[model samples]
Structures are given as structure tokens and as C-alpha cells.
Target: MTNYDEVPYPDFIHPATHPGNMAAIARLHGVNAPPPESCRVLELACGPGGNLISLATLLPSSHFEGVDFAAGHVKTGNAMIGKLGLTNIQLHHAKIEDWVTHPESEQDRFDYIIAHGVYSWVPEEVRQSILAICQMRLSANGIALISYNTYPGWHQRQMARDMMRYHADGIEDPHKRLRHGKALLSSVAQNVPQGSAYRVALEEELKALDQANEAYISHEQFEDTNRPCYFHEFAAEAGAQCLQVIAEADWGDSTYEQVRPDVASALASLPKIRRGQTLDFFRRRTFRQTLVCHESVAVSEQLQSADMASMHFVTSSSLQGDQITGSNGLSGTVEDPTTRQAMECLVAEYPASMSYQELCEVVETEEPRSLATLQTDLFNLVCVGLVSVSASPTEVRREVSSHPRALPLAREQVLRGDTVTNLRHQPIRLDDTTAHLIRCCDGETDHAGLVERMVAYSMANGGLVEGDQVVTGEESLRVLVTAKMTSNLQRLAAMALLVG
Candidate 1:
């Protein structure tokens, strides 16, 4: 599974990456933390410290040291670090094996060690060396984060890879191999070998290739792009090196409820902490690369469980929404109303497992909310680890629970329902009377009928309010007779309600 990491000889884009609240992720996994100032960090294959620089900037009190096999990456990261005026960050240019194999090397222990792209891309021996570095260097209270490719997902990609590799095999030059892969994928079938699984993939890949720009093709077909791994196989490989699965990077999509497709159900009993369906657990349509923590922790001292200890684990992001829905049904902060609606859908779906790509699909192909809105909702979910996250193949650690009771929004009366589910998981917004009125809003109820109900109720009370005593207006909610008659027809239509 450690097939693709640690292989970038001298190529990497140097975009500044954002950092999640690692202190919080550790708390969810039952790990403790000292203050940022007291923490020591290490990042294996720190790509220009894009994310690490962000992390350092956010947690200035923390100390960081990074190693990348690519010397140029190290040089670039150092340049950024210098520009950022980072006092506590350091970098090294050397392979994991070279560093660990040094006999008299200083034992480099860390509080929180993260390696994103190196583990899966590197060769097996190098991967083992990286794990050894963790085992030998990770402090007691320290946690090591390693990311790699996963199964089930990789299984499908293997189909595409098989076709690519098959076409690639006949060519000796790397670019030629790439051309073959691109050609077969884009070419129309000329008596395609009957029922070849690779045939369809080749066509699809070809179409995608022709449409894609040159930059993408060149990067994807790099000489080192041939490495990959499976999910369970990755876990086993990590186990061999004494690493444990902490959680997936992106969370909230799969909680325990959704992922009920026949295939997911069959894997249901596999001792999953929580389960759900996912396409890309994080980012876009890319396959997963799991993050792992060392089984043996560093930092022997007991940690202080301040506000951070109780803080929910979520990806660090600036999403836009007025309110976000927690997996537990609690509403979180958002920038707008639309964001709120999107949160409701994520909550309603409540799958045990969801890939980042799958959630995007839900947002795009379904009701198609704004990308910013969906991201904000996901960010809130990530903060709490309710939707744990990983850009690579990852696992869900938190349990998924159903919303208490989804009550429909109506007008004039309140109706309690058991449970309603859908991908368009919007919230039950309207209040009791309003909700009931909405349900009955067929443009049929007359003001007379409204008055009759009021009068009948008044008669039962032995008295009735006169027209003078009652005020009615659009803004005044009491004008239920008219307001409930036609408030959210358009919105309901958008929700695809069958009501007339």
C-alpha cells in the first residue's frame, strides 16, 4: 500500500495548505495534549510545508521539524519558513531510510508527527523505514499521522489502472506508455474484446484525457504514478509497522446509517467503528489515502484537558452558513440560510460512511447547493469529528446516530412524524402552525373557514375576539389564514413536494 508516497523526486506544487485542529483529533481518539508551546511536531515528506506552514502559523507556540526526500522541496519549504519568519519550524533534505539507518543519529522524537504524501508513494522498504522513524521518534503523548491508498475504492480504480497498464506495457518509454493509455481510453471500440472489464474504463479514461488539459495528463502519467494499494491491505501494512487507524480525514458522510447498499451491507460486520458510503472521503473525486497513528504514543506526562479536550473534531475551514447541523441534531454556526438548508441534507442523509466525492455528488447532482455552502457544512462536521476526515482512504471512528425526531414544517397545526430520510436532507424549518398550514395549503382554505375555526374555538371559550381586536398583516404571523394559504409553494416545489 505504501506504493505512491515518498517517490516525488523533485516535483510538487507549493501551495500553502491549511491545518486542522490536531489537538482536537487527538482528543477524539482518546489522546491527550499539552499546550501548543509545549508540543513538538514532525512531518514526513512535508511538501513545501504547505499545510505545515499553515499549522505552524496557527499554532505559533508549537515547534515543527520536517523531512522530505526531495532536497528542492526542503529548500522551497525553508524559503517559505524564512519568509513567514517562523522561529520554531525546521526542515531536512533526506530519505526516511537514510535518516533512520544512521547509527549515531540523534533520536528525533515528536509530539504530533504527520506524513501526508510520502507513505503511500514510497517503496515498501522506505515505508517500513518511515514507520520505524515514527516508532523510534514519536513521543508518549505524540500521535503519528500516515496517509495511504485504500481498498474497495482502489479496487475500482484498479479497473482503470488495468487498462492503462495493459496499454502501457506494450510501450517502453514512459511518455509512450502514457500515450498508449490515453489512446485506448479515448478510441472507439473496434471489436472490443468481448466483455473485457478494461474496455469500458479505457474508453472513459480516454474521453476524460482528451478533454483534460496537458498539465493534468503530464502530472498523472509521471513515471512514479504506477503505485497503489488496498484498504485492508493498507491497515495490515500499517499494523506490521505498529501503526493504528485513528480515523478517516473527512467525516460526517458515513456515520452508521447510510451506506446500506448491498455491497456495504455485506461488509457491515467487519468490526467497523462506524460505516457509510463514500466516493472520496475528502476533497473531490480522488481516491482515498488513509491517515494512521502509531500504536505506541509519545509524551508520558498527563495532558491538561482544558476546553480543547472537549472540543469536537472537525476540519479547520472558513465555511459560509448561518447554521450547521451536528450529527447529534445540534445546529452549528453558518454564514447564511442556504448553508442551513445544506446542513439539514447532510444530517438527514446520516450515512455511516461517505467519501468527500460522494458528498459533493449529493450536493451537486441532487438539489445542487452551492459548493461553498456544502463545504461550510462539512467543515463544521469535521471540527466535531462527527464527520471525521481524510483526503486519503480513511475510516470513521465516531458512531453515527439518527436525528431525535424529524418533524415536518407545516402551518396552522403541528404534526409529529417518526422519521424521514433523503439525499436532499434539508431541515424541517417551519413551526407547528405554519407547518400544518403548509401541508394543507392547497389554496383551498377560505378566510371564512379560518374565522369559523376561530369562532368555534371562541364559542367553546364562551367568548370571541372581534375583527377590531385582531390585527392581520404579511409580517404579522397571526395572519395565518392568508399567510399559511401560500407561503412556501416555490420553496416546496424546489424540494419536489407533490402537494398542489
Candidate 2:
């Protein structure tokens, strides 16, 4: 096995794997899943427990367990769990093959089993063991999320991986291997003949590699085993284990908005697994986070309106006129009057999620509509990626407090680096100024005290300055720091990084 202690993969939360989101997806498909508020969650290959710990902070009532082969990862994750004073989550140092051997592992079936980065990266035996665990250890109605690299898209990435590994595999140092591998790929991309098909694919792969972190490149590209399978093949294998893929974890990406209506109509006629495979072939999907359940479980892709009664809605999108502009800058027009108003309400709630009933009440107050009608409209918006649904509400402060307290997990993260996990289990990269501001939030510092601390820190560093002019006077520096502090605090609040 490759030692991850040498070049540790950066651990971060994946919101799609959150039990709340998974439960919502389950409900959308008519699966009677365990509630996210009290669900038992297990994560395989959970590095340092970043994702599990973040979930623990949010859902204190739920229990989380993570299993990893690496001792260093387990040690680091256990240390964080201790510091956070959380009793509901535990990180264990154990291989996946050995995990099922434990008596407790077999006894306590998890409501959610997550294998985020494990499927495509491991050998066939390990992969089979993962599926077996999911089959035997998952709750009767549980949803196990397994993410993997798929074919078509992986076909291109495989070529790039082979070239990089061929050039850099002999290197002993992991970091050097990553550097040389990337350099080799870059050189090929630059030297390849213009307008050739290979050049086009290589350049696209290089573009993706450029966005990836060194840890990702090291583990994903340079690892000994990476087996990308077709969606149908994966589905068939899961079926062999008595598991069925219900749907993709990301509902929006699974929609037919990208394909033509005729293609979608043709796909809709096919069986569920075949439809998914055909869709993947059309989109050339490189990766998938699939939600699987017991083969006997009755699954329905047609979402019921009643399910929304227990759900909440949230989005970082802005309602500009009739168009809802996503956080990523993609815009979708909401033509229906009621849905447009509902979108307005969702946008106003930004980081804080509003319960489905609460949003419907507010929207109905302005524009009357049946609950079923409203839910259908909202589901459409969800499929379009303009909004998202959650089975449990995300607890976050919409208003900045007099003495803002950052989440303990976030405070711990800031000490390590600029990237901190928010209340939503999403990672937010902070600027130096914002990171400094977060470090000062301890619920004891008053607004004025915070400003004074920022002013002093700024002066000691290099003094507060306006573009060209360095402000030396105490009053001017205080005023500038105050404004900057206020903006930073508001930004943190909007990011759901603040607790109280």
C-alpha cells in the first residue's frame, strides 16, 4: 500500500455525502431512510475525519464512525475529535477488509455508508469488500454513497495518467513524482501538434490537473491501482452484491438539461440503470457519486410532493429579475410567478436554510398556490441547480452577533491554515485578513475591542493603508480597521462560519 503519511491527501467535507442531503435524495426516490438528525453514519477512507467531524458539529445527536488504514490519519482525526469534545463520532485505524471482522461493525448497521474517494482508487479485492460491507452492514433503508471515476471521461484521463506515470513513476519522493509527472504532461501538451485529437484531449486533461492540488495528483494519478469502469459495469457489480444504484448523489447534474429533449425522451423510456449508463455515455461523465440501496427496496424516480413537507431549501443564488443567477454565475429563468417569489425567499435566506413549510407559507402569503403545485415548481428548480433540498435544516446565524463566536471546528482549522469548513460542511478558502478576523472571534471581544485588536495588528504588521497612502494616525487607522473588520465579519457570517 502507498503510504499517505508522506503526502497526506487534504481532507475536506463533501456535502453530497451528508446524511441530510442523502436522506433528502432518498425521500425524493421514495426510500424510507433514517432521519439525518439521528442517523448513524460511517465513512470509509475518511482522512483525518474532516467530513465526519464537520457533520458531528452540525448534527450533535447523530453518531459518526470513520475507518481508515493509515495510523497517522486515525491519530490526527482522533485528536481533532477530542479537541472538539465530541462523543458522537469516532475514528478507527482499520483496513476495510478487517472492518467487517469486528463484531460491532456487523451489529451496528449504519444509515449512511460513504466511500467518497475509495472505489476507483483501490484494487479489485478491496473494491469487492467495500460493496460487501455496503450490502451486509447498511441499514434496511440506508443509502451508501460511492464515488468513482467512470469510463468515456476516464478514457481521456487514463491516457494522460499513463503518460505522466511513464515519465515520473521511478521517482522515490512523492512530491517530486507529482512535480515531474505534471511537468511531463505539460511538456507533452505544449509540444503536441496543433488541432490534433490527442492534443485536444491532453490539453483538457492538463487543464483539469492544473486545478487539482498536489495531494490529489499524487494519490489519484500516481497510485498503483485506478480502475475506471463503465456505469453499467459498476451497476451490474453492485447488483451482484444485492445493491442497486438509486440515483446520482448530485441531483442537478443527473438532470436532462444538458441533453436535447429527444435524447432525454429516448433515455426516459429505458430502464433506470440503462438510462443512467446511456446518459453517462452522452455526457462523457468522468466521475460519479452514486447512491445505492438494497435490491429489495422499492425505488421511484418520480418525486412525491409530500416529501418536501419534511425538507428545507437553500441556495447561494441571487434572484435578479426573473432570472436566478447561481453562485457559479450560471443563470436560469424562473417563469412561474409563484416559483419566482419562492426563489426570492430562498435567496434571502442565503446560507440559512428555510424549512419547506416556512418557505411555502411566506410564498403563499404573497402569491397563493397549492402545496403540490409549489413543490413541483421547486423540484424543477432543484433539478436545474438553482436551489437545493435538505432533509434537515442547516443551523447558522443569519445575523452577525455583538460578540461573534466562530465554530470551534473552524477556529481549529484557522490555526492550521486559511481553508476552513463552514456550518454547511463546505470548505471556504479565506484571505489573510479574513483568517486574522476569524482568529479573533472568541465571543469575548466586543466590537470596539475587535477593532482595536485589528488596528494594533495592522499597525504592527505594516499599518493600515489606502492603496498608496499609509494611514499613521490612530483615529484613521481605527476607522479603517473598523470598516475592514465589519466587512470581514459580515463575509464570515454570510459564509456560515460564525456560530453565535
Candidate number with greatest TM-score: 2
Model 1: per-residue Cα lDDT over 149-213, one tens digit each: 55554555555556667777756555576777766555534447745865665655566667754
Candidate 1, poorest ten consecutive residues by summed lDDT: 400-409
Supply candidate 1's per-residue lDDT for 112.
68
Model 2 reaches what TM-score against the true structure? 0.95
State TM-scores per candidate. Answer: 0.51, 0.95
lDDT of each prediction vs. the true structure?
A: 0.48, 0.85
Error of 2 at 121 (Å): 1.1
Q: lDDT of candidate 2 vs native?
A: 0.85
Clashing pairs in 2: none
